[model samples]
Target: MTEAKAHIVAAVAQLIDEHGPAAVTTRAVAQAAGVQAPTIYRLFGDKGGLLDAVAEHALATYVSGKTVAEEGDPMAALKAGWDTHIGFGLANAAVFGRLTDPARGADSPAAAAGLEVLRARVRRVAATGRLCVSERRAVELIHAAGTGAVLTLLAMAPENRDLGLADAMYDAVLQSIVTDAPVRTADGPVAAAVAFRTVVPDLPMLTDTERALMAEWLDRAAGA
Candidate 1:
């Protein structure tokens, strides 16, 4: 981005921090950025565009500070990711609200990226035979839980917020998505089915058509 574009994004972010999303007007941002209204228009098209830029920039900045755990328990890593997500939302409420907004949702690039990261983490859990559901299902459940937790906290006044709510929500989501151990006991069939589905595309012994058919059957077997 050009220096001017960066300036405008930063200025808009400051306005959001000082006030809120509703306070971000073109006139206010233009004045704060020391740029004319038309410059913002020319650079960002409009206030909506400017806010999008701010959200993307702010999210990326927050994500940069996150440390990806290279070695440890997969479930532990997943919990770390969850904690980072909650921290980001609490620290950047306006940007997080925009991300969780029904209309904006995954339409925002950052939100989509975040989901992909969560999917990869869920895949790691599935690979370990701990996932009780298909990888996709687990990801959706975890995402929904995390988003709901953050939004629920944000909706309450700070002192009134139940700090344990987020942890409880995570536990509930994890219980739904994972087994106490590797699915080697009574749930063996479900775990095997899910683990096999993840490797379906890599099965060179079978033709694409055969692999696809096998995947369909596995999908049913996994109850996905």
Candidate 2:
């Protein structure tokens, strides 16, 4: 990004943080960035484009601070990520609301990157043989739960919020997706299939097609 574009995006993001998404008019942003409103139009095309840039900026920062635990308990790492996600949403309500909008977020690379972070965490659990469903299913469950938790909490007055709601949602998701202990292939095909699915690409001497075929079969067996 050019220095001037960076300056404009930062200015608009501050406007969002200070006022609200509704306050992010071209006039306001232009005033904030000390440029003509047409400069914003020239640089960003329009308000949606400006907001998209801001979303990418915000999610990039948010995703960077996130760490999928490298050691110790993978579940613990996932829970930490959950907390971070909720905290950011509550703290950045205006921007979070905009980014969560289906129309805008559907095409967002940063939003997709955010999902990949969740997928990595799910993959870690699967690799540990603790996932009781397909990795795709586990990721979907956690993502839907997390998004619901944030939106539910945001809908309420902060003082009226159920402080335990987010934790309860996490527990519910865990119940559906995680096993208390690793399951052996003899005990169940689902968890074992999920576990092996993580390593199928690395399996020795397999052609790409072979790996793909195995993955398809495993995905079906795991009920994704």
Candidate 3:
């Protein structure tokens, strides 16, 4: 993004932060950004488009600055990611709401990025032979649980909120999708398939067709 666009987005975000989403008019953002209202329209198309940009900018910026634990422990990194998702949702309620809205969410780059992050974390856990489910399933479960937890908490009065709810939901999700290192670790054959799936492309002595076929088989096994 250009400096001018960044400045406008930052200004709009600040306006929403200080005055709430309902108060953010094009004129207000224009005044705040020291630009004409038409500039916002010219750049963003309309108010909805502008709001979309703000949501994208907020999540992208937050994710860029977020730090997870140092490498080597994928579980720790996954836990950190869960915590970060919950914290981000609670802290940026408006942007979170915007991103989660059915109409906007389908087209939301921010929401997609968030899911991609979860996918990567789940893939790492799978690669470590710790995940019990397919990466896709794990991502869906965790994402749904996290979003539900945040929404549940957001629905309550702040003082009346149960701060432990998020953690509790996470624990439940982990119990459902994570293994405790049973006799067959990595959630058994399905998890093994998932772990192996990651390396299918790099397996030596395999033609492109063979690698593609192997990946397809692994995907079926993992999804089983």
Candidate 4:
């Protein structure tokens, strides 16, 4: 994208972040971007189009920043990917909300981008030889659990919408799915953690190295 278009998109995102999606208006975006309102309409067609572009840009930027772990031990990579996914969501709450909100379904390019990311992750796991042909269902289950955990965490405590909370939720849900084990579903952090472990047993325990990588990825993703 050109610098001008990128700036416009970033301005729109900032507006949404500061004022929520309902506050986003063509005139407001154009003013924030130092452009004329007609320019926005001419380039994006409508307010929905601008929102869609922002969502798509955010998703593409986020997914592009991810490292996808290494080429070996798909399980390890899968765990790493889960961590990355949750971390991105926590760090970009406004953008994540805009992408996942069902009300935005008609214009949500981010949702489609997210599904593509999921499908690609599944394909990678399937290629690892760790899963049998009959285990495709397991892969799907794990993916669903991972996403579910993230959404659950966001819903439960908007305040705990940080990387730590995201990691705990993902780990709990992940363990449940992978171990076929029962997990607590109480209304606390402990319950969230347990749910994560139940769904994703192989969820990376995380390390300083991994955290450092995540920080780097976030820096790149935020265009900083």
Find the candidate with the highest lDDT and give its number.
2
lDDT for each candidate structure: 0.83, 0.87, 0.83, 0.61
lDDT of 4 by residue, 1-224 (tens): 67877899999889888887777887788789999988888888888778778877988887767555436765667677777777776667666666766776645454556556655554454433222221334455655665666677777677655556556665665554343222233423232332232223243676767655654453333222
The 10 consecutive residues of candidate 3 with the worst lDDT sum are 178-187
Writing each residue's lDDT as its tens digit, candidate 3 over 1-224 gives 77888899999899888988997898888999999988888888999888888989999887776554437788888888888888898889988888888886477665677777788788778777667777888999999999899999989998999979999999999988777653253338876787888778888899999999999898898784
Point out the higher-scoring one by TM-score: 2 or 4: 2
Q: How does each model score on TM-score?
A: 0.88, 0.94, 0.90, 0.60
Candidate 4 residue runs with Cα over 4 Å from true position: 1-4, 102-124, 132-139, 160-224
TM-score for candidate 3, please give it. 0.90
| Residue 202 lDDT in candidate 2 | 94
lDDT of 2 by residue, 1-224 (tens): 78899999999888887888889887788889999988888888988888888877888889877766678888888888889889988888777877888876487777788899999999999998889899988888888888889999999998999959999999999998988999889997899999999999898889999999999999999998
In angstroms, how far off is 43's CA in candidate 1? 2.7
Model 4 worst lDDT window (10 residues): 190-199
Estimate the Cα RMSD of every predicted model relative to the unseen true structure: 2.3, 1.4, 2.2, 14.1
Q: What residue pairs are clashing in model 2? A: none
